[model samples]
Target: MDTNNFEETIKPFFWVAHKSSFSVCLNAGSYKPEIFETREDEGFEGNGYDWGSLARVFLDERKPHLAEYVRFDPEAGMFCAYSSNPESLKEFIVDFKKACEDDAVINDLFSRAELD
Candidate 1:
């Protein structure tokens, strides 16, 4: 598939909050994605999950260069996935979507919310 063309044709946004926050954005590369800490007033309510520690673990497991493009702020309990490579971004979306579908907790969380 021509992921670059596909990516260019769509602007997608995804948000998930559990014990932490995770978001995905397609076509966000041009926006110069950056890491920003979330504030307590932002309504991130969760317990027992250390977002910062999780971010570090995730980053450590990936290639070092990925850290340059992806941003994770544990303090704010958020992770932003962005990359200049459309194919990589597309792959991330596909993999994450499948994971969410397979995970009962994630499926239930999304299904119950009126995200629309």
Candidate 2:
């Protein structure tokens, strides 16, 4: 995942994920992940570049959607998972959080999600 132009590489993956409606960063971190409805917004107070929002540098290519599988870690990279039953956000988020803690469980959830 090493590259000279980080934005060029990461932006496309996120764009595809956004369009496909995949969730991102399903973890137990303090900041929870989100599933966005649109991408009509951009910029940080017009681009101040807040700390720890590294994804923006590349995603700022057009202001990335908030819906992509999301718990981002500058050091560890992105980990993603999904669920078909998004009708209940609270319940699924809880499931995602618990599943994300284990790689196998999250992958299993993603596999099951893909079948639906």
Candidate 3:
């Protein structure tokens, strides 16, 4: 993998951590988890920072092969995974989407990443 080139292609996203849940915005896009007030049941006691770390570990273990491209920014609650091979990236995204649907924590982070 071309580390320098891969780093150059990384896209940064923004997210907002709420008391329990969080929201993400992509490329100046609208904030997701928009109906925050109504999602009280989805809220957790932990903060976004903690969730970010959890997300990092989850993805690392869940898709060990993609470890090289997966990165997590706990401070911003942002996650990025990039690869020169579009097919590989697409495969990872598909697996990740399945994971998100199955795991709540991953779902939260994935939703915030705005990957879909």
Candidate 4:
């Protein structure tokens, strides 16, 4: 992998801890998208940062390997693997970032940068 290029891609954005208002996992590869509660119920333990992996599914298809978000309160970028393969999450983060950029509500949420 081109570690430097990957690092470069991630570097421009500010890392912030994200609390996903809505989250789920899905078996979209199947006939229809189905939620995976097993992953959801795990809650905070679901992923180190507790990000919803399924959200990646909604991300830009151009980046098919959507992965993890770099949370700021947690305040550092840490790599975590996808469920089946280890590559999905990076693209997910990129897509998510784009979504936030394109949508105001999402961008607003991150703008406050303080949670109660």
Candidate 5:
């Protein structure tokens, strides 16, 4: 949330990383119909973003409470990161910001691969 940070500064790097990993999902052939054919199949949606999606991706399993990547410890509500290595999580946040800032970068990254 650094207002001074510009997307252009991080977009190129974000695109590279996103493409390398997400290209697989884009090309999964059956992914779209199987997972996205209907709104219901798409899990949760809001503002064109899946707010809790990252938690689901990280946990990859059902749990009673939402899996919080950044969590509050129950004993004292102390903040803790539940899932990834701290550096990786930081990089991901940066990448997300970059993607959001540059629509062209986001477009190209997704266009490079097909969801179906």
Candidate 6:
């Protein structure tokens, strides 16, 4: 897809949090699709949020860039995904990835998944 199309497709997946406290880029590449959500930690200070660490105890190989908030679920044998907003991560990411695919943006982004 052209650059314009690609941008429009991913618009929903990108957002500025806290006036640019940080920028989050959520992209779903080819694989078993998953979801993520962010939660508010009441005990913490302003915007108290935390996404647990990405576990790598048993991976055949490690992809650090693609392994944020990624964890191994002993029972499932798959990664347990997390999100900046865990509560809305799954649904938001699904739609976000779909939007990119629908616009043929995935082809362009597949190569850049490492940057995500």
Which one wins on TM-score?
3
Lowest-scoring 10 consecutive residues by lDDT in candidate 3? Answer: 28-37
Over 4 Å off in model 2, which ranges? Answer: 1-87, 111-116
Summed over model 2, clashes come to 8
Off by over 4 Å in 6: 1-79
**Global lDDT for candidate 5?**
0.31
lDDT digits (tens) for residues 45-108 of candidate 1: 3211223332334344434445555553332333355455544444554544343344453333
Model 5 CA deviation exceeding 4 Å by range? 1-82, 113-116
Q: Give the distance in Å from residue 12's predicted Cα in candidate 2 to where it truly belongs.
A: 22
TM-score per candidate, in order?
Answer: 0.33, 0.22, 0.38, 0.28, 0.29, 0.25
Cα lDDT for residue 26, candidate 2: 23
lDDT tens digits, residue span 1-116, model 2: 23354334332122113443434342222222221101113321211111123232323222234234233232223333332323222233343344445556433333222100
Report model 6's TM-score to 2 decimal places: 0.25
The residue pairs that clash in candidate 6, if any, are 36-89, 37-85, 37-86, 37-87, 37-89, 38-85, 38-86, 38-87
5 versus 6: better TM-score goes to? 5
Clash pairs, model 2 backbone: 23-68, 23-69, 24-68, 24-69, 24-70, 25-69, 25-70, 25-71
Q: Count of backbone clashes for each model? A: 1, 8, 0, 16, 0, 8
Model 4: per-residue Cα lDDT at residue 36: 23
Best by lDDT: 3
Which 10 consecutive positions of candidate 1 have the poorest summed lDDT?
Answer: 30-39
Which pairs of residues collide in model 5? none
For candidate 5, give the lDDT of residue 95: 50
